[model samples]
Target: MDRLEAMAMLVSSVEEGSLSAAARKLNIPVATLTRNVNDLEALVGTRLLIRTTRKLALTDVGAEYVATAKRILEEVDELERRAAGEFTTPRGELVVASPVQVARLRVLPVVNQFLALYPEIRIRLVQSDRIIDLVDVHADVAIRVGRLRDSSLVATRVGALRVVTVASPTLLDKYGWPETPEDLRELPCVVFDSPSLSPWRYRSQDTGQIYTIADVPRLLVSSPDAAVDAAIDGIGVTFILEHDVHEAVIAGKLKYILQDFEIEPIPVHVVYLSRAAMPAKLRRFIDYAVPKLRELLAEFGRIPSA
Candidate 1:
């Protein structure tokens, strides 16, 4: 049996969750994949997987073996890429993950310009508000906001985003300005139902105490853009990242309020897995894109009104 080929099949099957799915991805027959995995188990002297109608579950031994196999496969891939001059030449597909709004407003423009500059590099931009696992998705890099807790990943902070409270000028005229955090009780609020920013948090400038406002929302929406629109239509006040309301604020559709109560700026970052032999494509994109993003955030992403 070709040990490396069998290892590759086993890893693919484990990741893809089924032999048939892995076979399809590897472009081989399902029977062929099964044979390779069975042969591998026979050679290793243990059953590696618990095959089921719904899915494949790894045995304790199988899990350990698969982890080692992945590392070996990655080392081999790196060696092959180095041999093929990919380390010297910046040419390959690069997968980048980012938040939806950041990608739409900031990262997309940089990606467009990067593609024109580096003709050989291709990028797959994955936009999501939820956190994406780099290893699970095989992403080359990601744009991240807020604090990062993953010790395994490396991060380079580009800039910061402020969380600001805003309302339509019309809404403010009716409700009047919120002079203190306690004053929000009198006004209607549009809540963007994200766990990170929910309950409407604020920081005191004088006392330095953090406050949470838990009053019932006038409008509840899953998306930040929807909440911003609702706020602009004079529905209610919404607290969101400056990136979401920057344009609307400039156009006079929205106005910043409770400026003293806003929290510290949330840091934005370019992140990736720690690699010993980082690919040239990944390196080039980071080098090219980081400065452009920093400039964008510095000029536009900062708290504009104050």
Candidate 2:
């Protein structure tokens, strides 16, 4: 028996969930595939799989062996791809996760352009606000905002971002506008439930100071989008990421206040699990995404070369 080929067959069988499925993928007969697995178990002097009519289960030893086999196969596949001059050709499923707004405004366009350039690469763009379990979701990469809680994942700095206080023109016309952060207390405020908890932040031009404004909100909502809607409807002032309110501000739907009191830029990142070697598809996407994101955020200004 060819042990390497048999290992590949076993791995494929486990992944495909049935011997017949593996057989179909490998284009080999079911009997031939079963024989190869049996021969492999015999050669290894142990039963690797427990076969049932409905399902195939890996034994404890089989489970451990399968992990080792997968690593070996990946390395072998990389070697083969490199030898064939196909290692750098990006072609595979690439799953990425990001906050809903970021994915829609920033990452989706890049994803579209990337797919156009690499037709063979399939992408799953997971738009979410809560932190996603990369392993559970099988996410290959993630675009993260603010500080990352998980230190285990490898993170690359994208750029810094800031929050802005904005209100709709209709709202501004109804309620008197605040010239400074302290003046916000007189007007109704819209609170957004986010990781930031809607803490109003500002930087002082005269004293060169930055501080968080502690004002109770008249209206509160679970999402930034909702808060913006309320603000646009002449409800209250809301604090949100500058990017989130960019369109509304540009289209004259919303207007910003206390621009002089804007907060210092917060870091943003692209994080992924630590890998023995990054897949070509992932590496290429990172290379393509980082600079583009930075460029888009550059209007927010760079972090002064620290």
Candidate 3:
């Protein structure tokens, strides 16, 4: 038996709680898993598992061996990868996740360009609004917008999005721009559905204080994209990320309002689990992406940190 392969199979079997599951994960037959494990037990001269019809439980010796096996396998993998010049030559599949619109606007272009430079790297992008547990989802990296929750992952702040209040040129011309937060209550308003946002909690640069807008929604939308569209059609003034309407703002269809009174911009980040020796694929991607993201979003974003 290949002792290293047996050790790996035994570790997988114990963790998975079944030989069948381990076999499925490793893409090997259950018989092969059984044969290797039996061989491993014969070599060690002890029973490693207490197996029944439905479940497999680890023996005392098996538990200790599994722990040691995992550490040994990790070291072996690192040694082999390094020996093959993997640290210098990036070649592997990268799994990444991001919210839908952000993925399309922020991440997709960067990934597309990256594929051109490294033909060996394949990308699998998972788009969802729900925050995924990187370890559970088996994702290698993620693009995070807004404030992040507590996590052990390494977060590199890329830039700050200009989440400013905006209105159509026609509405501004017809009604004129409001001078104070209180003025918004009397004007047509667009309300977006989000938990983190509060109509009252905004930094007012004009007064150098947090200002509360007592405005009620003249129109409510589920998505920020919809709010921007409503504002462009002369519906009402709405708070939106500047990047979403970068082209329209330049085309004079929409106008940014209360620049001096705009609240603090939200942060954007790229987050991943740290490793002792980082893989070339992940390291190179981060190096290639950070500056490009800063540059691409320069028109509608601010780099809060160097």
Candidate 4:
């Protein structure tokens, strides 16, 4: 039997909780995976897994073996990478997660350029508005906007984005622009349904005072794209990151109001799980990404109306 292959299959089966799922991930037949695992058990002279019709459970011995196997595999991988000069060279798959709008408008373009420069490195991007559990999902890095909760993760500030109130030109023409935050109470407000929308917090940089607009509608949506579409259709005034609507504003499709009131600039960060030592892939990515992100933010800052 291929002991290393069997060990890999065993680990995958344990993590996936089923032979079928392991097969799918490993790109092997279910029967082949089962046979390899059985061979591994026989070679070790012990039953590693307790199998039932409905479920698979690991024996106490299996749990111990799995931990050792994982460590061995990781070490072997590290050795191979070093042998290949990857310890000094950044090459391999880098999985990243970020919100949809940020991915589309900012990250994708930069990633495209990065890929062009480093053809050996592969990038997998997962875009969603919901927060993803990095460890559970096996994401190498994440780009997050706004305030972050306390965690063991390491975060580097990339830039900041302002939340802008925007509406279609026609809608603004009809409803008229509000001079003060209180005037927004009468106008149709497009509310983003995310947790960030709660209390509608704003602060004045000049006065150092905080204000929040309350009693807003609960027209919650999952994505900024949907919210922008709603605004473009004249549904209501919606709040979004200025980068998201900069093009629309320039095109005269969207207009901003309440510019004098200081909405706090939400900090953007590139976050990764803390490790004893940063791997080459992570370090190289940060080195490459930081400067590009700074340039992008500077470009956004120079936008005429942003």
Question: Order the candidates by lDDT, highest first — what do you get?
Answer: 1, 2, 3, 4
User: Which model is ahead, 1 or 4, in terms of TM-score?
Assistant: 1
Q: How many clashes show up per model?
A: 0, 2, 0, 1
Best prediction by lDDT: 1
- Tens digits of per-residue lDDT for model 4, 1-306: 888889999999988989999999999999999999999999989999998877789999999998899878766876787788766777888888988788888788878887888878899999877777786566789988778894887898989887888878887788787777777787776677665555576666468698888755635666777788888888887788888788788888888777777577888888998866556776888788878887787666534433
The candidate scoring highest on TM-score is 1
TM-score of each: 0.87, 0.66, 0.66, 0.77
Ranking by TM-score: 1, 4, 2, 3
Mind sharing the TM-score for model 2?
0.66
**TM-score comparison, 1 vs 2, better candidate:** 1
Report how far off residue 141 is in candidate 4 (Å).
Answer: 2.5
Clash list (residue pairs), candidate 1: none
What ranges in model 3 sit over 4 Å off? 1-88, 195-200, 205-207, 211-216, 301-306
Could you give candidate 3's per-residue lDDT for residues 88-142 as a string of tens digits? Answer: 7898778889876778898899999999999999999998766777854557789
- List the lowest-lDDT window of 10 residues for candidate 1: 297-306
- So what's the TM-score on candidate 1? 0.87
Error of 1 at 70 (Å): 1.9
Candidate 4 displacement at residue 132 in angstroms: 2.8
Q: Which ten residues in a row have the lowest lDDT in candidate 2?
A: 297-306
Better of 1 and 4 by lDDT: 1
**Which stretches of model 2 miss by more than 4 angstroms?**
1-89, 204-210, 299-306
